[model samples]
Target: MRKVIVNNIVSLDGCYADATGNPLALNMDAAFDQANLDSISAADVVLLGRDSFDGFSSYWPFIADAPEPDDPDAPEARALSEVNRAISRRYNAIPKVVVSDRGGVPSDNAWAQTTTVVPRGAAASWVADAKRNGDGDIVIFGSRRMWNGLLGDGLIDELHLMVSPTVLGDGVRLFGVPADLDRIECRRYDGSPNVQLRYRVLAPRSDRAS
Candidate 1:
């Protein structure tokens, strides 16, 4: 079966919410941006929680052509425009599995073409089915709640974390495990401004002994 990877940007204190008072500034790390785009490029489907979807829907679409925060003709502005365009196209084209309890249909637009709202309890099975359908690895982004649920159920195969330097006293934590995580193999990448950590889930001790 294809792997289900969870990719998220987190603060040193583990908060995933808006840290700089601006929602767009949540997990604002250049390294994380590049890494997230790379993950999206590799995955066949992107999974998101309802809350994350709402946030992304409002931000990513219009940002592409929006006026630059700084100089419009500057290199940074051009780069932002290009990245936003790429993000918009990729998000619109890739299949999206949104986990929600609402049981309603996605909106009638590009969101409809690529989006499906799976019931909360059925998310793991739906994700497994998608992976078994010959789709490449499914990448789940944002949605700390979803991450916690999937992690607890042992549905997540790998975790790609972009650890930022800043810290928030309290906010949305990415890892909300109640018990200790089973054995994990971690590989660290020296991605400056933000460190990248890749963890492969290992079999539980009891399973390994058998």
Candidate 2:
């Protein structure tokens, strides 16, 4: 069976994206890029909402085609570029499922050859079925709404959250409901203001009380 892992990088205030709906507006550095690579490499399939689908499809392929590191940049910059390339390649290789109620995801479906689009109404059940039958990790990236629904359905297995140094006093918050989780691991990036947290979701609170 597969485990659903939700990986997100957010501001200290818990905002995944800024007011402009730009997740890149938050703090992300070399450590973050390496983490991204690691996350994608571990997952065989990715589940996304419409917003995340649009965002990833429009960008990841291009990054995959980007040039390798050159001598002109700093050592850290070159290392970051290498990591970004690896991240995009992994994203392109993995199968992805996008949950969108409406049409218009492009006939070509250019992000990856294995893109699957399902209606929003059926997302939870589909994920549950996949988890029951599939292998490896099912990863969710930048789909706050989608993951929250899965959380309500008691489908999310684990969460890998990176808290950056900056705080977005006001932005689109990631958590709309309370969740019960058991911390699995926590680590900090040396010389950087990034703290990564891993948590295993417990059974729903109501279930535990009964």
Top-TM-score candidate index: 2
Those runs of model 1 whose alpha carbons end farther than 4 Å from true positions after fitting are 18-27, 64-70, 73-79, 106-109, 178-192, 203-210
lDDT per residue (tens digit) for residues 102-178 in model 1: 66544644476668888998987887676677658889888878867777666778888777777777665566664
- Candidate 2 lDDT at 171 equals 86
Question: Number of clashing residue pairs in every model?
Answer: 0, 0
- Residue-level lDDT of model 2, residues 108-201, one tens digit each, is 7676467888888989889989999988999998889988878878899998998888788888888865679899999887777888999999
lDDT of each: 0.70, 0.82
The alpha-carbon lDDT assigned to residue 175 of candidate 2 equals 80
In candidate 2, clashing pairs total 0
Return the TM-score for each candidate structure: 0.79, 0.88
Q: After superposition, how far is residue 167 of candidate 1 from its true place, in Å?
A: 2.2
